[model samples]
Target chain A: MGMARAIEMAKEFGIGMVSIKHSNHFGMSAWLVQQAIDEGMMSLVFTNSSPALPVWGGRSKLMGVSPIACGAPAGDERPFILDMAPSIAARGKIDKAIRQGEKIPTDWALDSEGNMTDNPASALEGVMLPMGGPKGSALSIMMDVFSGVLSGSAYAGHVTNPYDPSKAADVGHFLVAIKPDLFMSLEDFKARMDYLYQRVVSCDKMGGVDRIYYPGEIEQIMRDERMKTGIPFTRGEIDALNEEAKLVGADTLNV
Target chain B: MGMARAIEMAKEFGIGMVSIKHSNHFGMSAWLVQQAIDEGMMSLVFTNSSPALPVWGGRSKLMGVSPIACGAPAGDERPFILDMAPSIAARGKIDKAIRQGEKIPTDWALDSEGNMTDNPASALEGVMLPMGGPKGSALSIMMDVFSGVLSGSAYAGHVTNPYDPSKAADVGHFLVAIKPDLFMSLEDFKARMDYLYQRVVSCDKMGGVDRIYYPGEIEQIMRDERMKTGIPFTRGEIDALNEEAKLVGADTLNV
Candidate 1:
């Protein structure tokens, strides 16, 4: 809803900013970036979630693994979309590992006792390790300040976990949309973006590497492939979705 | 100069943006952020420099270890300032290690052959390793896109090295200033920032850990101490400065 409004406002003005409070988790920020790109606009998407990572030098969780995402439009090329979390690995990966009974890498998380652990269950009981130590920790704090504090939402580790149903999530988001032609003609701006995309992907390859991908190129490729091949889902996943659909009296996926 | 104009424009309007091309290294980015803070404004500072780091999978140097910096003002408390390079360690640190005849950490850089090495000279010949691997590489690319490509300056590892006298540096910069009180009163924004600062510093410490610092707080502390006790410079440093001063017919610092 906020993104819809932001796009409308940005189309009228040169830029639009929307700060949302008391919201739920917005899945995959890149989708929002793509939405703005569809309108030929640049965007910045920021949000704060429940605490799952710790501040630097602290053992306990005090910050979210919230993502920092942004994008710019291009001409006849994939747009530049950057969506990254401060943590070395996403928390959902651990849950998946637990479901598959697989062991995680030691660097991904610390156990409840602060010891490095490979057990997925123990990793979930502990804290996700921030990437690049202090740099990642600082990035998480930056998100909280911009999204939570600025939006008057729960912050400073107070945001309720989505899994925890004791109270409201009270999440916060900071969204911005900027016209790509704000300072120059749309054609010129997109030409620059296309040139940048060419330079990045055409760089000399390293040994044993076949290709270099732009920030969001891998996802774009996967999306194109999926569009043709259709999504590959396991039987269990299909069953789970069907169950939810039945509960909501919605049409289930046809296998 | 761009910062001064940005401040003026932001003061008159609600926001300001300045894109500069064909410039020289502007030194520490924090100074620019501080300039905006002095004017009670929030700022984003970005620049592109000569190649010293590599893209994620590429062994060759193809990106600048450019710093991404931003800041916001606060009331009666230390403001938020973040200035960080994408590399594990700053390139200047390697030069300092060479001057002191010290070995850098093996993780700091790769040898010319793409192997990790502790020798500072060999590391200089090689590329500085990006922090958090792909995340840092993507960040450096983002800087180039915004500061170099968008500003119509040299990019894609084309910016001349500062120490290379073969050609002009032709650096580029992107600066933006936003009114912090755009959504609320200045006092409320500052109060929220103060609260964030307090929460971050007061986080529970891990085992054998000391006090945690807010972003840029360490530099503020160092600046305060150096203001009173003065900066400690080696005899060689002082002599080099005095020599340059003599050549320029300027007054030298007192010993």
Candidate 2:
């Protein structure tokens, strides 16, 4: 909903910045970027969540492993969509591993004792490791500054976890939409984007690598395949969704 | 010079964007961020240079290890300043290692044959690895898109190296200065920034770590020390500086 308003404002003005406070998680930042792309706009999407990673030198979690996401439209080619978390691996990946009774990579997280661990359950009790040490830690702090502090939401490890039902989560988001034709014609800007996409995908591959992909090309391909073949959902996940819908008096899953 | 104009325009219109084309390397992106901070403005500083890193899965260099920089001011605390290159280590570090006959870390770069190398000279002949694999690669690509492609400057591995001398550098920059008080009073914004600084520095320390620094704090400390004790310059560096000054008919070093 905020994205819709931001896109409308960008169409009216040359740019639009919407700082949302007291919000919940909006799944897949790429979808928000795609919303702006559908409107022929460039977008930056940032959000602050509960603490999941530690600062550079600290052990305990002090910052969210929030993703930094942005996108630009292209002409007759895949758009440039970048959505990345500051962590070495997404927290969801750890949760997925736990559900499948699998061990995660040792580099992904540290156990409660600050020792690197491969056990998914132990990893959850500990802290996610930042991608590039100080670089990733700083990026998460940047997200909190923009989304939490600036938006007057919880920050500095104060945001409540969704699983902890003691209080409101009070998440915050920073969204910006810019007109692609701000400094040049829309056509030229898109052509440049397409050219960039081509250059990125056509780069000489390393040994044992197949085709290279543009930033968001993999996601796009996955989405296309999911469209043709229905999205796979665990029976447990389907039941949970239907239960929530039933509680809200909304239509349950038809599948 | 671009920062000066950006600050002026931002003061007048609440925001300013200066996209520079066909320029040379501007040392230290943090200095540009500091310029805006000095004027009590928030800023984003981006630049594209000669390619030094490769795309995610590619063996050959295709992107510059351009820094992503930004900053905001604080009331009575150290401001928020982030300036980071996409590579694991700055290219200058490799050069310094070569000068000192020291081996770099294995993770810093790869040899000409794509094998990780500790020899600085071998790393120089090859490619600097991105910090977080695809995340860093995407960031460098983002820099090129904003600073080079959008500004009508050389991009996509076409930027000429400074030592090449075969053609103009044609470097590009994207600078944006924003009024920090756009959404609230200047006092409120600065206060928030100060709070953030305090929280970050006070994070719980991990074992073997005595201190945690906010982003750019180390640089700030170094700059302060350098101000008190004159900057150390090797005799060779002094000679090079003097030669350049003489060629330009500028003041030669007195010491």
Candidate 3:
């Protein structure tokens, strides 16, 4: 992915943004931004993928559940991080509900007939709706423009799916990295960030609630827990990854 | 406000951002971003306001229905714009619904006791819910960080309502502008944008749908139509505008 190179360029040249045109799916945008923040850089990233959500108020799927991610460092434990897709619910989440034989909320998706549905199976066959309706749809379009159109990458329906054997994915990404020291002292900036995090989390809580978290707080906790527990993988996953590595003549991941 | 100045700075340089603190409530952010794009610059704006929404699963009203706005020129007709608050429903809309004696949606707000309610009066007395649970709550926090915290402005519960006569609204705003020419050719960028827009709106429509609009399309239509037929105002609105104008030693408009 271009994120690593973009981080390097920003550190060297103060501010650098890269628009990656032709690439495979880049795993979680949070991971990429946190990578930059670890090196004392503030980062914003946008990426477009295959269409999943329909345009707000429209029936046809026209936009990706594109992600918007941003992060910066703090003086304390967790960094300020935000990573979210435009959709109200991701298809992966719907799939999980279906696998567990659960009904979904009515807001999650529109059935194939373009009417709201609560059935998980119908939702899976239908289109996922964007968060906040038109607003999220617009955000998805902007992400696509920044990552795909601006970068001379695939745009709209032209973008392919990597999971489909006949398609090439053709994902596009846009990254903006800023050196924290360029605007203010890195130490001071970090201190200010920590102050903000503290203020937000220390606020009065609701009854029956014992914990408050900033955007990145829970994700950081889960990532840590998973690290301690070790990542789980199916046998098929390991074999598939190893086979791809073999084709590329590279050392394979243990998976 | 800072949006205009940020746009100027971004055009002079390549990229420029401004964070303003201790400010009055800036009007709808859509207007600000549209202003920038009209001058051929891409813009993003974040503004924090009085607390109106609670943290995702929390009972306390500790966060504002902060708005996020962004826009970029698309060919020659209109800019692609997105402007939204983090709440599932805006107070203004809820107020209108209450005035019309309509029942609100259950998911839109919590009752005073933190139970979901469809009663408009109870919803108004309580707090609005976030658009997509945790995602909207996180976005709201990010807006506060960018506008209020980074700018050394009032944040969270400290941000007061301008409408409350006894309190001063120490609102804050963050603006970012980028010169289109700095990234790529303006014409080419616009062309690509037109291409993307065309692809999206032209996609096959779902049943009973005749059109698909990109973000800002409806706004653009209304603006043009209102331009042909002058903007309408209620008698009270006209009197209020005149009174505010008189306080600033400005001429009164003939309505």
Candidate 4:
């Protein structure tokens, strides 16, 4: 539904806009953010799920592999989007590595015994490491609090896995959209953002470094490149997606 | 100066109420945040300085030993404070390690040649590592954009060293304070925050983990413990502080 219409419906419920609770896993955070950006407002979205990582110095899984995405509209360019999981490597990354028969990077994950592992399968059975040790763990905890606790939804460890269709996973998602005119002129903010982007991109490079890319720069570049070259999907991922689509009586993409 | 008075003066300059730029290195990010918190406003502060680390995958130095702090008041309890640097270990931690004749933790620092080192002196001559590699580096870059670029102040390598007395560093600081009432009631936000905090604290503990801690919990505990037991300072640190105090015609603390 259009965000405006959704907001109107939320008003009928006597709440500030609508907050989604127990949402099924969204494909990619950026995709959801783009939906909100299409309406010309700043968007912030968060998701919380089962504990897949431990706090610093602890061996047990205690926090979700939370993710956050923020997007803002620009005048002539694509929206400035930032999407990241609080972990060093998301579980999906590990799965991709496994499919490619590649070794996972060291220290990115730990085995069931809490020992570091490079085998993707072992890493999957283990816990994904937080992005910056304790700091990242703290961020993950905060995301859970904001997305789950504050939203009055399911929290870490209790959340269901979207891949497992047999059981319901009470997933929680929090979203906040602000009209650009709420704080400053949208034109001014866009101009400043553009100028800042240029300055950062034009910065002096360190040794052997050829480019300085901003947060969403590479993704934008990738989208353009993929549009021409076509999206690359592994054989397994293609088969799985196709099978799911077929079950739903939907046509699958040729790619 | 009182925070309210300072903010009023800032407003007189045709800027926001809490404009901060080129402020002398405040003692601690938390201290300055507390000042803003006392004024019944949410606070965000950022500081930039000399190169302490390299970007992920690059061996050469590029960014400063920057830090960011944010604080929001909660009812009845101490404020919610989050203060951290993007580096694996702050420069102050290295200094403390050296004074105590202890080896620095692995991965925290690098020698002059860009190889990892445990010697604090070598680490001092070299560079500190960003936490969790690229994620921390990204955050460091974000700090630059938010604090330096947004405020039209010095960034990264251009920021001066606050410790150096011979040359003025032209260091930059960014402070932002927002009245909660502008967006939501203070009481409502605090109550939500308290609920979030309680849920996280009440979660099941991982093996060998005794208790969970919110962002500012440990610091508050430390402050209380130190108040009763007194802070311990090395003889050399005490001597250096005393000499510096005398040079400024100020009395040294009695320990």
In model 3, residue pairs whose N, Cα or C atoms come closer than 3 Å (at least 3 residues apart or on different chains), thus clashing, are none
| lDDT tens digits by residue: candidate 1, B1-255 | 798888887777656778898888889999999999999888879899999887876777888989988888888889999998888888899999999999987767877777778999998888788888779988898888778876777887899999988898999898877777766888988898898888888877755567889999999999999999999999999999999999999999888
User: What's the lDDT for candidate 3?
Assistant: 0.80
The local lDDT score (0 to 100) that residue A129 gets in candidate 4 is 79
- CAPRI grade, predicted model 2: medium
Weakest 10 consecutive residues, lDDT, candidate 3 chain A? A200-209
lDDT of 2 by residue, B1-255 (tens): 999998887777666778898998889999999999999998889899998888988879889889999888999989989999998887899999999999987767878887778999999888888987889999998888878877878898888888888789999898888777777888998998998889888877765678999999999999999999988999899999999999999998877
Kept native contacts, fraction for each prediction: 0.42, 0.55, 0.41, 0.11
Q: Pick the candidate with the highest lDDT.
A: 2
Docking quality category of candidate 4 according to DockQ thresholds: incorrect
Candidate 1, residues A135-182, lDDT tens digits: the string is 888889878877887787889899999999889999999887777676
The list of candidate 3 runs beyond 4 A from truth reads A1-15, A96-103, A165-167, A181-184, A203-210, A233-255, B1-5, B8-13, B95-103, B164-168, B182-184, B238-255
Best of the two (1, 4) by TM-score: 1
Provide the lowest-lDDT 10-residue window in model 1 chain B. Answer: B8-17
Superposition error at A250 for model 3 (Å): 14
lDDT of each: 0.85, 0.86, 0.80, 0.65
Residues A95-166, model 3: lDDT tens digits: 899899999887788888888788999987788888877778888898887788767778876678767878
| lDDT score at residue B205, model 2, on the 0-100 scale | 74
Ranking by DockQ: 2, 1, 3, 4
Which runs of model 2 end up more than 4 angstroms from their true locations?
A91-107, A115-124, A238-255, B91-108, B115-124, B239-255
Task: Give the candidates in order of lDDT, highest first.
Answer: 2, 1, 3, 4
